[model samples]
Target: MLVDFSAPVAASPAEAEAAAVSAEQVGYDGFGAAETKHDVFTTLALVARATERITLQSGIAVAFARNPMTVAVLANDLQLISEGRFRLGLGSQVKPHIERRFAMPWSRPAARMEEFVAAIRAIWHAWATGERLLFRGEFYKHTLMTEFFDPGPNPHGNPPVELAAVGERMTAVAGRVADGLLVHPLTSVAYLTERILPTVREARGGGLDDFTLGLSAMV
Candidate 1:
């Protein structure tokens, strides 16, 4: 079994980095950092600088708390820092956090997340191929990208994006737009087979060739 270590959400950056180092030494296939107490990207960046092999992921970075351009930049930089070993894990937090804590708009979360991922991809494409940044969606708009602000194509290419899902609508969105799906630790086998898999299968057109399904179990 391919095992991954999830850094404690309560751990500080230093603690997480040390844990990640130990995880790598012990032959963990991957390490995931959460976005609870500290910035997930920041913690992962430290972990990335310290480790060489184990894949790094933001167990979840709140997608609604930040814009797509910022997220694209962060993920791109992390991919470079980790030498192509980075995976961007994004999630749309609950409405209270989105609206009150983050002071961001909250409506049609599934649709918004799909557009968010699309916007990030559009920005990366613009940087990679000098394409115009013209992604105008119902929730986000980005029609400008000047050379002065562009970082250009990354050497490691863009990192793969994974989305966390509980509901079928969000799961469908994840299947449609994300490279993978992050299954919650609370997900039951029955629920996965009956609800999640069916939704993803239908959304993915009955194929999961290039898709990754990550389940967090409390083994």
Candidate 2:
């Protein structure tokens, strides 16, 4: 499991660092950081650089805040910096927050998520294949790839892509494509097992193959 270190109640980097270190010392699988009005990636990258052994995850960095191309490059760079200990977790933040706060438009959340994931994969695929990128999606379109911009084949293999999701539609999407599932905390265990897992399982036509299960339990 992972611990969310970002909170309105805690403002100190030292506190977050201490919590991360302590979590590692106590044998936690990973520690997750969330992006808000405050910084998330830089802070978590620092934590990743500071710690050893324990995996560092993004709880769900807002996909709309930056382009999918940017996320692919940044996530790949951080994963490299952390020696492949980084997990890129993405989420489409709520409509109001995304549109009003960030001034980014909101499309169909599920459809946008699907396309965004596809775009990210395309970027990684371009990196791996050393081939020109030719991607066209409902939300994003990238037709060309240049030598200057492409990262070229990640030697460590692309870092795992974790999708933070809640609704049945989103869960089904994750099961069909995502490397991991970031479950909503508000869901009960029974709801997860019965409603959520079944959707995922049904999508996979049986069960997932080593697909990750991440539950957000309130402490």
What are the lDDT scores of the predictions, listed in order?
0.94, 0.79
Could you say which candidate leads in lDDT?
1
Reference-based TM-score of each model = 0.98, 0.91
Candidate 1, 117-207: lDDT as tens digits: 9999999999999988899999999999999999999999899999999999999999999999999889999999999999999999998
| Per-residue lDDT of 106 in model 2 | 91
What would the per-residue lDDT of candidate 2 be over residues 1-219, giving only the tens digit for each residue? 344443332334555566777778878778777775456677667777778888878777888877889888889987887788888888888998988888987988888888888898998998899877988988899888899888888877888888888898888888777888888768887988889889889978887787888776666
Worst 10-residue lDDT window, candidate 2: 2-11
Q: After superposition, how far is residue 177 of candidate 1 from its true place, in Å?
A: 0.6
lDDT value, residue 26 of candidate 2: 77
Model 2 spans with C-alpha error above 4 angstroms: 1-14
